[model samples]
Target: MADQTRRVHFVLSTHWDREWYMTFQQFRYRLVKLMDRILEGWNTGELQGPMQTDGQAVLLEDYLEVRPERRAEIEQRAREGKLVIGPWYAMPDEFLVSGESLVRNLRLGREVARQFGGTPSCAGFTCDIFGHNSQLPQIYAGFDQAAALIWRGVNTWDKRTLPWEGADGTVMPAFRFGLSGYCTYAHKVRGRPGSPESSDPDWVRRQIDDQLAWDAECTDTDAILFFDGCDHNEWDPLSYRILAERFEEESGGFEVVHTDLDAFVKEMAAQADRIQTRVVGELREPAEHSLMRDNQWLIPGVMSSRVWIKQDNAACEKLLTRHAEPLGALSNYLLNREYPSGLLNVAWRWLLKNHPHDSICGCSIDQVHEDMKFRFSQCRGIGEVITSDTLLRLAANVGEPVEADSTRVLLWNGALTPVDGSVEVTLQIPADWPTFNEFFGFELKPGFRIYDAEGN
Candidate 1:
């Protein structure tokens, strides 16, 4: 006999990709409309509280950028926990970017959430990210995140939930989506009666029966999750009404509630001892099982699709993290100079704008990638200027003043090891020194020579 007493938590959320098949601006126009409707619904009591914003705070930033007048309204909704936002600034492809980028993404997201008088959700929500990394649990634990809700790149596991262990043995409770994935309940709200695409009134009852049967085989617990929205989906006030009225009329020994991801995590946590499955390491398998009919493709081709974007992304990451940031810190510590944090923050923001799964994975439209080039250049240009200025200041503070007639060169070793090999350096010569003749095949100009600190 089927379990008569089942508790279903319907999580309402929309996975908003900043840019994908459409340009960011084109999508933003729709986003503006979406936010307007959502806020309106909330105010009128048509839609109940607690809607997840794709687990990313960047959407809030994008929405507020256009609807500046709605800031206080958003803050009120956020403060009341009616709007669930990030533990991530953007949903990025895990394998493509550096580890430092992921850390900063979470840091920036929480910072933004607090700025708006909101408490960021601690669940590591990777609903639509291409894949996940092995150290992700460790990363989440570092941020005090309690659990993870994931969709793609989860192959091997057939159960609905498991203890996902990171590479370093840090374990966190993780919920993996079933065959229908996150949009299992989306059709219910989207296809209302009287609409052109509406289904039979009996469809809702049949769906619940089918989903509950599937959930029975997947887990022993009565608490199950059903995400009620999909990509770029708009807010619908009917979702709450439909579930409440239908479930109340039928009863059927099933209890349905509208809740956030954090509440679901807590529910699952209560049953942790019963969950025996342990999935360790990264989750990047392309599911080939028959049961996973709606399984998402890993789409490994995105890694190499637009090679130039990857190249530009790597160059900018190195410039900001390895060069600019370290040099700035050194100047602050050694020379007693204040760090240029504002400049570095701007550079990081521009770079992170390019880290979204679609943007960085090179799976977005041509116009999207073209716009990414501008953001990359902005981050790189800022990093280069900071590196140059910091180096000049450090050189001036460390060495003795050079003679007026002599030229001096300072070498900076950014690496941790000592430098013992021959190094090549570039010198700036006075414009009057010499000009190479175009007619001459190869001409050597007499330039300044280099010397060690001892004038060897």
Candidate 2:
């Protein structure tokens, strides 16, 4: 027998990657099957849930895209609060994408969760990202999230619960799942923790005691959090009952309950002084090689792998932010017209799908990166069209004249003040038209030359 005050919360969650090494279609088949099993078991009283996802709304979106008929059942489960989802469109690689994109991801996630009759969990779930950035607290706080459940980038000296601070002096609770990661305490019974081969009375008592002892060493709180799932894990719907019954049999010193990150954060907050509070920002440690011992992985080099993808991603981001959005807004304001929000969203979703750590890092299978290249192409193509259309409309309204054998172009400075820049024009001449050598009185260069729009 131990102290009466000790308690433990078993968090049942899956760190779901919508697509990583596997293609989205391949994963969606498994996802549909898994959700069907989970819902059926719960409806028939075979599964107990408070199950949480990796704070991703994109998985549900992908699932609904394929199986719109099951929307009612999924929505019902979400309303019951048995299914936890969102607070993120996808679990993004923070540093690889822009800070603004991070905010938009959360915004879309929350919107999707509400559409499904579910309130997005208030916890920031950052389980699988290779590392975290300094402004994460601000981003999460902007969404009104209370805490973050993180797996990587914690030192041995750091406590399980620490205060994470952002650049703007915002602070929030952060939970690190140790070097072993989220599924640390899971037993090998049914691929989920807290389940065993034998639920015999003696085995139950021993298991509880061992767990309690291990729990004590990890944190100062009497409550222990055992994350029960891993990447792409589909839960055994009936396993929660097995854990509940076994814990009930050996109910001597502690209580066990299936809970979520939100509940755990609230419980810990009730006894705030017990959790060590220290300001933390951008954390990158316990390198990829080190995590291999614990059966976990995080490759930092993915940030630079497949340099072409990274370059394209940066160009797409710039084209949208610098050119399309500003030009669209200016056209809308001056001409009383609307920008193509639907097409813009379609383009954004395509890009965001490629933001997952493994996909963006170019560390996944060849097929996944190949698909990413295609998605990047689509994103850029859409952005370029939007920018081109907006610019054309604005130019037409400028009422510039077309002189003989020459064209007039109007270029607006999208910035606050005038900017000094160069514009290059390429001309394709017909057989009857003047040759470059004849026109310029010299031999033509191989390619187009850069010059000022003013013909300098």
Candidate 3:
């Protein structure tokens, strides 16, 4: 990952967000329509030169949005080291993408990557949460990715003023931008709300000129990421190549290149002792028993969010925690191959991305009824959960407390058992309850309480 002179990097971070595309049946319609469009474009060969590489439509899987057979085809491409529309998970934000759900997403994404030919080392947020967290060194390490870019944190930095991390460990690539300045060009532009079909080459060229002027005028380094429109659906092979073509026709001798975003980090890593690190982590302190404070965003860093987003993310985290067990069961069942592959595929696709039948959200009349039956089959039919719960109950019996003693108290706290656990406790619990879910039925002694923790 050493630096090459005048690096021209190209990266395509693609994603799909459509209302009707989550359900199975509707997805079918989308798939057919898109497939027809691609095939037609292929036949006409309207796609030429770099367009073949850039213009080629990719089905980015924030969720595995396809049928099993199509997934197989993608896998085939992956095995051959071909990069055809990789990444197949919803990428539910990593910090709180539910451990079980994240695990499942990774497992499924891995399968899809294997079938396609290239394991997707790079991940795309499409502008959800902010920052490339330090905790994610392990995440990228897991996916064989050395780094990722934060499209959101373009000019936001502190201290070093280059693309350096703040007090938190949010990494951005600002120095690279400073060196390049605005070698790229464009024109005849009008800025809209957020770049919705307005900026012509003239406008872009003007921006480039301003960038050049800014570059010449400034003595110290000023950082800026050239590519705009990170959150919107502006970045595709079509738009990128169009820009490239413009540069080719207009920029005369300036070189343009394409590279995966990670390439930037890897290249930078070669020169310095370490790529500068910092990002916003804890903006506010977590006061005792205060949920709001625990998740607040105070410090400005790479993933800086207005108050609203942090609150929404916190809420999502709570929801994920509340449903951890069922989530774990779903993951384990799928990983263990507890049922037929197709049935598991149907279930997770429904949960994570789109439906297996037609490729949309919410089942059709036919699918809804069928899905109700299928879910029951996936959950209850396999009996993994039921059997596992039964084992938990039986196993606790052998480890019974050695004759309840005043000195050797079993430390009775909250519910001795949750539905997800083997042990259950009585109706009422003691003073020092260790927070847990209570279920029906239980037996308790006069002084001794039954209520215990979830896995009690």
Best by lDDT: 1
lDDT (C-alpha) at residue 227 in model 3: 33
Model 3 residue 430 lDDT score: 44
Score every model by TM-score.
Answer: 0.91, 0.85, 0.48
Candidate 1 vs candidate 2: the lDDT winner is: 1
lDDT minimum window of 10 residues, candidate 3? 48-57
Q: Write the per-residue lDDT of candidate 3 for residues 1-456, one digit (tens) a residue.
A: 222223333343323333222443454455455443443443465422111111112343422354444555444434443343323354444443344555556567656555455645343222322222334434434555433333222333222223333333544332322221111221112244347444355555555456434432331222212333221132333344454554333242223444443344455444434334433432122212232212222223312322333343333333333332343454455444232345445445445442121122122344443443443344333334433443343334434443433112132222235445454533344445444433753643244433333325
Q: Candidate 2 — worst ten consecutive residues by lDDT sum?
A: 445-454
Higher-lDDT candidate of 2 and 3: 2
Cα lDDT listed for each candidate: 0.80, 0.72, 0.36
Ranking by lDDT: 1, 2, 3
Candidate with better TM-score, 1 vs 2:
1
Backbone clash count for every predicted candidate, in the order shown: 0, 1, 62
Q: Residues 327-361, candidate 2, lDDT per residue (tens digit)?
A: 87888898988977788888888888888887787
Candidate 2 residue runs with Cα over 4 Å from true position: 1-7, 187-209, 237-239, 246-250, 277-279, 287-298, 399-406, 412-418, 427-456
TM-score of 2: 0.85
